[model samples]
Target: MRRIVPVLALGAGLSLALSGCFVNPLESITENLVEEGVEELIEGQTGVDIDVNGSGISLPDSWPSELPVPSEGTLQYSASIGETFSAQYEVSGRGTFDDLVSKLEAAGFENTGEIEYGGLTSTALETERWQVSIVYIDGEDSTPAALQYSIVDKDAP
Candidate 1:
């Protein structure tokens, strides 16, 4: 009987662990490859550098000095979208990545994809010609932050 109990317990634990492997809607939206690719594209076009440490993405020296100051728990970065350029930053806060998603949705930004990079989960959003991203730091008290960049087009009709 004791052996059976241990076996059952082990099986139950394995089941629970496996159940968590299912893709969550929020996770799906928070860690996307497409968004990462877009970010890379923007960085390449603007010649702006990005250094994403565990804390957040560091702003490059070439960044404009007049960018808005991020909230206490937020970090911001600049990038280019298509033709019109913009700045993107991240807002880190109390709640986990889930909280950031709620705030973004509340702010009228739609979830696009999920991106897992540098041991963090980044949620991506876009508005017409702009691309924004928010990354959730796993075990820190830092607030969620976003990446805001613009798209530039010289020949617009």
Candidate 2:
């Protein structure tokens, strides 16, 4: 847990930085080099393999098969640590949160908790192997209708 947070931070930072990082095709090469350098530095410091596919973010290669790929949003950010993953997205239209909930239920997660406070909503769901939470983070520090989500491996230690 102590070592994994920086990898998550790098991934989140990349979510915001990607647009500015890739200004043009020619500069994309330099950006890739910079990205690699950052990955190496973070890996050296934390030992987590922090791979962030920015701009057009997608699920990590190791994304657990049981998890649903979110269908309602542009991929804003994703990071994987072994089998666990965290992702954020800028959603579209209405019912995006419900869409996420329905998919997780279809994947066998049971709704374990829900809360609405301070004008934000969040839901938590879980399975024998995993637990997930999705929360609205659309005001102030986030994009409109954005969702922050994560799936934790129950057996991770």
Q: Where's the lowest-lDDT run of ten residues in candidate 1?
A: 13-22
Question: How many Å off is the CA of 95 in candidate 1?
Answer: 1.7
**What lDDT would each prediction earn against the true structure?**
0.44, 0.73
- Residue range 44-91, candidate 1, lDDT tens digits: 644433332223555455443432233444443333222333344444
lDDT of 1: 0.44
**Can you give the lDDT of residue 22 in candidate 2?**
59
Best by TM-score: 2
Cα TM-score of candidate 1: 0.31
Q: After superposition, how far is residue 5 of candidate 2 from its true place, in Å?
A: 4.7
Candidate 1 at residue 57, lDDT?
A: 56
